[model samples]
Target: MATPVSGLCSLKNKVALVTGASSGIGADVARLFASYGCRLALTGRNMEALQQVTDKCVERGLDKDEILMIQADFEVESDVRKTAEQTIQKFNQIDVLINNAGVYLNDSVENVILENFDRVFVVNVRAPLLLTHLLAPYLIKTKGTVVNVSSIVGRVSMRGLLTYSMSKSAMDHMTRCIADGLCFD
Candidate 1:
């Protein structure tokens, strides 16, 4: 069943930025947002998959220009900054920022190398932090929302995912801090 008008009203005509939108949860959110008449800026490492998602959004009634696809690798700092700038450049305003780009490394502390741990943290935690910082001004101007996608592992211990769990825990904390800060701002 569809959500009632009151529930859906706020999303219509809003501009949303969704990372990791080439597939999975990010793509699904982008599609739903587009269906609600939201303009979207999508980013991911896979251009082909991102294009497919954009096509689906277009089919859902969004014009080609209403959707912007940026291919960005979260591990690269320059790419992360560029993604935010490009989104703002295209849309002029951002009403929603979904920090959903992440990496999962399945290895215990005993086997995980420093390189793997660093890569996971960079993608899962640092990138989101940087993106949020870069877009804070625009988001504040519009009183926009920021949705940080976290994992259950952050709350509960999981085997073979030490780095992943830690990164998610950091994200959860970051969300709380940002929310509190926003309340004051």
Candidate 2:
């Protein structure tokens, strides 16, 4: 049986980079991809947590040389760029890029501070944009794909999440704009 997204049974020759891979959806996606034989570059702020995920991948039969774990805080543009550089250095090219690092707060506008707003935008919006920009040429070279995890909050506004919603809205628009601007043959 073949994988759902691609017809091939394995991604043996492909390389992928997954951000926020310490846990949750990112971790799951990385595991799934690894099972398909995709070499991975996984990133998260917590080194220990990222190592755990990598360990799981190793247990699943991925070779030690096939996984690269990068400790990064996506809020920092420098870190995001360095991640892209390191991944390229490790894999030579990235066949897929997953921007999955994100944060959420239950607090409403009244309780949300300016710092909170900045952190949300920096991680959820700016960081992804910068990373995408840095790695676009390589993606184009490989005819690769970028999957960004966006929230429904961007389209539906609810109380207490004003800033988060705004950031997601911006992220959605940015995604579309990048897709339109980049022409893939």
Candidate 3:
């Protein structure tokens, strides 16, 4: 017989890797996942905020050892790679990958520059792609899911957030392609 669902959001014992988890939606999700008994590898640019979130998870009944917090600058290739490596090293399995890390460049298309544009895309678009690539094998083994957090700006033209919007659009497309590519019988 099929098992009955528990609580409102139960992800018990599942290993989840959440990016941009220091403060914001990522942090909230991590807390929720923890409350539901998920093992987590959470990455963000701020160590302090990450620790605070970790503490909150503990307060929600998770053991301190159940969470791994990594300080990462998503725009840096080495940091992105390290985030994936460390997560796999800790959990040895990843059931959920939440791609919520993003960088916002407040520049219109007219004012956008190559340097700023590169930074935004590297953090908002490329890092998640690299993480998914590194984690795909584990995800496939578990038949897991990937959640890419994006903005409405991706679907609409935002005058001052041209680069950010474009980057999220790229992220949305990348998610779709990965989802399609990872489909298995």
Candidate 4:
């Protein structure tokens, strides 16, 4: 027998924070959530792109104030912390945390510069860790869920993207550990 969907998944009156909301899968996810009536906090380094996505959310019947855009580089810890703090202040609670901010250095470690690898780690791994740490307490208060954007490379090895894959491997393991820890009685 198939199970019926619950109203809890409707996302109505819920608040979601999506990093890397400017483009790609993150943008699409934000749109889908908006269609389900979720108020969104969209973050990206590109102000124009973030506003464009927010505009679409408003057009889709989300209130003008329902969408908040934080334009900051996810590689910075201060920016990550501020994004979470501002979202909590605006929405009073966050129903979902989408750690969609990430980078793909499409090169092997042999050819990849040290600085480039560091930036990839900062954006892909460190940023999500810091953001989740900041939001864990708030999420606990609401029993909220977290959605992390990880790549298939984490499961299947590829020719390039060695560091990127490693970071995602760490993220996948972290997700499992967190899920285990957050499972309630």
Among all candidates shown, the one with the greatest TM-score: 1
Clashing pairs in 4: none
TM-score of 1: 0.95
- Model 1 lDDT tens row, 28-119: 99988887889999999999999999999999879999999999999999999999999989989998999999999898968988999999
| RMSD each, Å | 1.6, 1.9, 3.4, 3.3
Which candidate would rank higher by lDDT, 3 or 4? 3
Worst 10 residues of 4 by lDDT: 1-10
- Flag the better candidate by TM-score, 1 or 4: 1
The local distance difference test score of each candidate is 0.92, 0.88, 0.88, 0.86
TM-score of 2: 0.92
Question: Candidate 1: minimum summed lDDT over ten consecutive residues — where?
Answer: 1-10
* Candidate 3, backbone clash total: 0
Q: Candidate 4 — which residues are off by over 4 angstroms?
A: 1-9
Candidate closer to the true structure by TM-score (higher is better), 1 or 3 = 1
lDDT of 4 by residue, 1-185 (tens): 11324753568889999999999988987887887788999999999999899888877678888898999798888899899999999999998999998988888857978888889889988898888888888898888899889989988889987888888998898889889888422
